[model samples]
Target: PAAALDTLARSLPVSPAGSAVAIAQDRAREKAHFVQCGVPVAPHAVIETAAQLAAVPADLLPGILKTARMGYDGKGQVRVATPAELAGAWEQLGRVPCVLEKMLPLAHECSVIVARGRDGTVVHLPVQRNLHRDGILAVTEVYEGNLPPAQTSQALAAAKSVADGLNYVGVLCVEFFVLQEGTLVVNEIAPRPHNSGHYSQNACDVSQFELQVRCMTGLPLVQPRLHSPAIMLNLLGDLWFTGDQPVAPTPPAWDAVLALPGCHLHLYGKVEAKRGRKMGHLNITGTTPEAVRTTALQAAALLGIAPF
Candidate 1:
């Protein structure tokens, strides 16, 4: 079992020292180290006990409480408006080690997924504006024309620096908080193929998953080329019907969508569903971002994902 864990750890894109440290702690120390190395991060502090929370400075109010480990897709997270809320938050988390991060006012959120090969070559994926419902990512829109070139470059540089620092050799994701000032700050990092990169499957020549496989297998990283502007809509469990004899329903009619040029649909082979769970996604590509957005919304609406 230890060998299995070691093999799995070796497959990750982190240095042996960093990986060992990460395996011992609840959170990845490499993330914090990256933030400290000229990468802007959401202001935060680690807390292991109620006393530490009590002693936190007053300026850090309106903060997000997150478990140091095993948190994802909005789970293991809570918001605290004041010190009075800290005790309850810690209790709710079963007294687990956690981090308190200052609440960031975001203009918009985006992510940059990168692939770095063993030779230290890096490739950046297209930037995607993300939409989340109740902390769960639900949709992503790839801006075709109106993207801020400088911010995209900054995001790419930050991702590369992180990867190079860790000697990362696979697909890694760097999420950003696009502030009103047009600055991109590092939000979090995922050292694997991410859900937000799903749009690449239909939108780009190389999907993030494929890139990861290539990197892990020692293949040279391929630059991702966007063929068309695309929009991705996530399918959630709420769309499925609930009954004693539940039948695996087919996706809503794509006749209208297929009629539109460049429309694509993909369904993951998931057997069951629970409320708010990710099921699959629809990617629609078109000549323009607006057209792609419009067609994607229509297709998602037809699939019973309302208010597109």
Candidate 2:
């Protein structure tokens, strides 16, 4: 109900103004906004009719078709490897409005979180290196050297430009795909604090949630500082299931996980366990990046998360 929320925001003190929310709610508008900000995005085409579908460029084949709205966590998307697959994919999506994005050779993914104030001030967190499973965020790593200095700078600048272009007045997360050739292209934007920024809770002096509050309450926005190297593993409900032929959900060994140095667990208290459901996250912090990585891997092992 982004549109409904946007309407409510017009009469309320919304952290993100309705205008920004409206843009982010629609892929067509979001991509247009990114281009208007001079940020690079993958080649794509909008398809809402048979004529438009017929007109799609051949170069955009081997692309992913994504619905224009209400799709997240890998939902409402289909991969089409050829022009012939376009119609079937679109039909499978119920003929909804969609965009076809040319698939790129991705080497990695990363994101930047920016907090912008009504006064036009923008401050950002360190770029986060991310890994996804089945199109859902699985892990996020933040620290010095997690990404090359140049790539980090590029991501930060592009994020700032997008926020400033929107005149956005809240925390915004800009996700990007790092091509094998080292080129960075904007993927999409989250209008509020995002999953990839979860590491900020334990690693930063000022977390993204605090930044949102500051923006909404008219408090001064302080640039967040990362005090420790951190890695965040998304806790999916799949973790609650244990052993072969288990009859019921069993809680993960939180005690064992917490025994490791610098491991912090945050559970959402989800009432049920279901595969692929985001239940919470584990944040690992340490004095050194190496120590954090080692501890994080150990925690992952205990939780059955694959090594990254």
Candidate 3:
């Protein structure tokens, strides 16, 4: 059955074998040793029945009810803010088996993306401070450049430990909660070129996607180096044309961005769009974070979104 999924992926127009294997391995571990790895997962109790869900601790209210598999981007999830909300939430989900975890009161979120080769050498993508809207990843900025030296070292070490423990190959990401006291708590891991690392495509010598392909295919990694301070702005579906009729071409403000120097645009070849879907990204590289931020926001505004 697992091989069926692998086969299906390979049948697609572009599927890398090494990446397929890495993703499968990550899914297995997330299901198996999630708690053992010291991740601050919500307090969860697996339940197949409404009665079982009812039996869960009341304190865990305001928790998330989630399906164990195949959930992403705020799908297949419901928030139970109180006892009265439980029955309705369960019914809405069609009584599927689910886990309930305590709601985390997070201050800010960040992720460390790592790339590892078969020989076990690993490289970390710069740490990114992420912003989310309605549980969907919206934008990310390099956070390590702003961190105190000691804190930055701690974050990198924690990420390396996770990569080594998993014997992970290819690009992998570990999301974390950066508390007010400056402590980092593990959140979750994704074993692929993560959304947070998209900025590397233009800012670094080797992009996360290329690193993923290289690591899995046994090619030596082209050591990635950031040439300049960078920022990335996500373009959501709301910016795209709608309806069955062909829409008039309103040329994007690419000219203004291109003229700014060190600005690059990447549009994923997705055929259609809907609210909240990631359509593309604009990256800006400059000497300072302020300059990078300014350029990135300008580019996004041209595409009709709030500042990054």
What order do you get sorting by TM-score, best first?
2, 1, 3
| Per-candidate alpha-carbon RMSD to the true structure | 3.5, 1.3, 4.2
Worst 10 residues of 3 by lDDT: 13-22
**Between prediction 1 and prediction 3, which has the larger lDDT?**
1
Instruction: Estimate candidate 1's RMSD in Å.
Output: 3.5
Off by more than 4 A, model 2:
243-246
After the best TM-score superposition of candidate 1, give how far the Cα of residue 37 lies from its true spot, in angstroms. 3.0
Model 1 regions lying over 4 Å from their true place: 1-3, 8-31, 242-260, 306-308
Pairs that clash in candidate 1: none
lDDT of candidate 3 over 246-294, digit per residue (tens): 6753435667767776688788877776667787877778888888788
Off by over 4 Å in 3: 5-32, 148-151, 241-251
Question: At residue 85, what lDDT does model 3 achieve?
Answer: 87
Best by TM-score: 2
**Global Cα lDDT for candidate 1:** 0.76
Worst 10 residues of 1 by lDDT: 15-24
Report lDDT per candidate.
0.76, 0.93, 0.71
Q: Is candidate 1 or candidate 3 better by TM-score?
A: 1
Q: For model 2, how does the per-residue alpha-carbon lDDT over 117-165 read when each residue is reduced to its tens digit?
A: 9899999989999999999999999988988888998999999999999
Q: Can you rank all candidates by lDDT, best first?
A: 2, 1, 3
